[model samples]
Target: MTSSAANRRTSLSAFLLGALLLLLLGGAAAVWALNRFPQVAQLAGLQPPADALVPATQPRAVATVPIGPQPLTNAVPVDALPATEARVATLEARLARVENATSRAESSAGRADALLVAFAARRAIDRGVALGYLEPLLTERFGPTHPQAVATIVTSSRRPVRLDQLAADFAVLAPTLKAAPESDSLWQTMRRQMGDLVTIRRADQPSQRPIATYDRAVARLNSGQVDQALAEAMRLPGITAAPAWVGNARRYIAAHRALDQIESAALLAR
Candidate 1:
């Protein structure tokens, strides 16, 4: 061949070989980028490999316990609780009974003490009445005040005089035995009359033996025989029927007896 035709054929062949090498290198780079980043590959409209995709894990199920009645641990038994309550009730009732009995006993003691105090007060009043009224009346009429007149009356009478004689002697002393004034206390008048009634009853005995006994006692008493007077006075109540004034007379006698007892006790104490 000629020289120009040979140069043109060599250049054309070199250009076609370089174009093939560039296309191969570009294909290898694209494959390496898709392996490193799956998101880039997906955005480029490419599907990811099976190894790059991860599966979601499933949740496990939990076991449940069945609910039932709980066992009694620290609670008291239902049967025993009622019995304990009944025992407590019985103890309370017994305590209440005891308290009531104690209250009644205290009330009884209070009433007894009150009665004794009232009795003592009555005795003191009776004693005062006897001393202040009866004794003075006796002394004024029968003994010291008119001793001569009493002596004349007793001497005129025979020993163991009859009831008629005794009535006469009382009649002679009628002026002294007059009723007390309306202004005076009834207690004073009653006490004064008690002495007179005793004197009359003592003299008006049915039997001569008692009459003699009374006359002798009066005679001794007028002569200051205190013990003999008390002895004689004590005997008169048994012989006579109880008059309306008997209670007053008995109270006077009891007062004197009590005084005698008190004096005796005092002397013994000394």
Candidate 2:
């Protein structure tokens, strides 16, 4: 009985090994048949789509922004490639033109802002305030030329001054300087007082009296000659008492001179 059982077990192991070998061979044969005949794969539901079965005849279309090469599966027809490339080129050219236009507009806007700031700085100078506020703006927009002019003006016009108003004040103060000096003799003082009392000069004509010098100074100040007016004023006897007026006149002259320099620099900049 032991001999019979051992033989039976050996026969069963041989049969199982034979079955495994047959299954492997059959699977390999099926694969070969599917490769050789597509109809066999289709019948077995293992065939790819018809489009996938053919090799791509055209290159794939690339994006305008360039994301690198694409696969053949993402390829397009050869006839449609020229239209796609032309469209991308046209879009790129239009985008370039738009960028150029934007650059030009920004440049123009920057120039406009500079000009406006220059105008505002001029107004501030005229008003004689906030002068320091314009220095950096002028330096940034027009460089050292305008900023230097502004600095000179600020230095020269340390005191606020105006020629027209100063002339009016001088007109009101002229009568005070018309009297004779305290150092004069009694005879001269009497004669001067008598001459003033008997004075009958024409209102429309220039006088030959000491007061005529003050009148001339007023005219010079009215004509924008602050230096000449101040010179004439200094010649008067009691001029030292009006030091504030003379100082303001000096500032007026200096400020205008600095303004002339600014104008010259601006013209050159233009």
Candidate 3:
């Protein structure tokens, strides 16, 4: 054999030996890495060694406690709930009553204030102040054409009639006639006595005098003779002396005097 051919054969044999040794060392490292970290070996496309691979284990049975019937929770007594509800209802009713009473009191106070204001305005009208000053107030309280307003005007404009004297006369006459017994004759006698007393009282009564005087005064007032009207109003006897009628008579006289004063002032100014 030639020397060159002998050298080539020696090189080929050394390469084969080196490759075999490298393959053995790589296989050992792969097995070791799979044992330490199997996920890394899997990512690298390496299979686990038979000793490193383990079969899956069955799940262990869990120890369980027996579930007996649960204990009942304590509940509120049914009777106690109704009592609490009733107490709440009673408090609500009491609050409603208090609110109603407060409303009534407020309404009464408002009416009293209105009455006082109306009385003051009436006084001013009688004290020589113009009726225009009081008209608005009266209209607000009672409408312009209301019966109450008309009555107030009429009562304030005229002297009061003394009818109380007639009541006294009737009282005196009443005792003169007795209660009749249950007999036709007694009843007739009692009727006769009553009739006689009534006739006498009627004859003595001066009832028409006040009426006549009031009519005269009203006529004078209509005729624009306020002075004459006041004179006629003053002639109403016993009206100013009677406590029941005096207040109204005074109011009427004051109104007349106010008109007279205004007229006198106007004439003087002219």
Best by lDDT: 2
What RMSD, rounded to one decimal, does every model reach? 23.3, 15.3, 18.9
Span of 10 residues, lowest total lDDT, candidate 3: 170-179
What is the alpha-carbon lDDT for the whole of candidate 2? 0.72
| lDDT (Cα, tens digit) per residue for candidate 3, span 93-166 | 99999999998887777566556545554455444344454555554544432435434544443432222332
Say which prediction, candidate 1 or candidate 2, comes out ahead on TM-score: 2
Model 1: per-residue lDDT, tens digit, 1-270?
688888988888888888888888888888988888777788797985555576656687878776898777988898999999999999999999999999888776755543443344234443332222323332343344334433333332212222233234433433322334455687876775565555544545633233444565456445544455435534542323323123333333343444443333323321
* Candidate whose TM-score is highest: 2
Q: Which digits, one per residue and each the tens of the lDDT, describe model 2 over residues 1-270?
A: 999999999999999999999999999998899899988888778877777879898988977875887669967989999999999999999999999999888776766676665566556655656557666666565555555556666664345565557977787767666655667789988887677667787898655466767878878887878888888887765576677788777777766666666554554442
lDDT of 3 at 211: 47
Q: Which stretches of candidate 3 lie above 4 Å from their native place? A: 1-76, 131-134, 144-203, 206-270
| Whole-model Cα lDDT of every candidate shown, in order | 0.49, 0.72, 0.54
Q: Candidate 2 has what TM-score?
A: 0.43
By lDDT, the candidates rank as: 2, 3, 1
Worst 10 residues of 2 by lDDT: 261-270
Off by over 4 Å in 1: 1-76, 129-270
Error of 1 at 17 (Å): 68
In candidate 1 the C-alpha lDDT for residue 152 amounts to 30
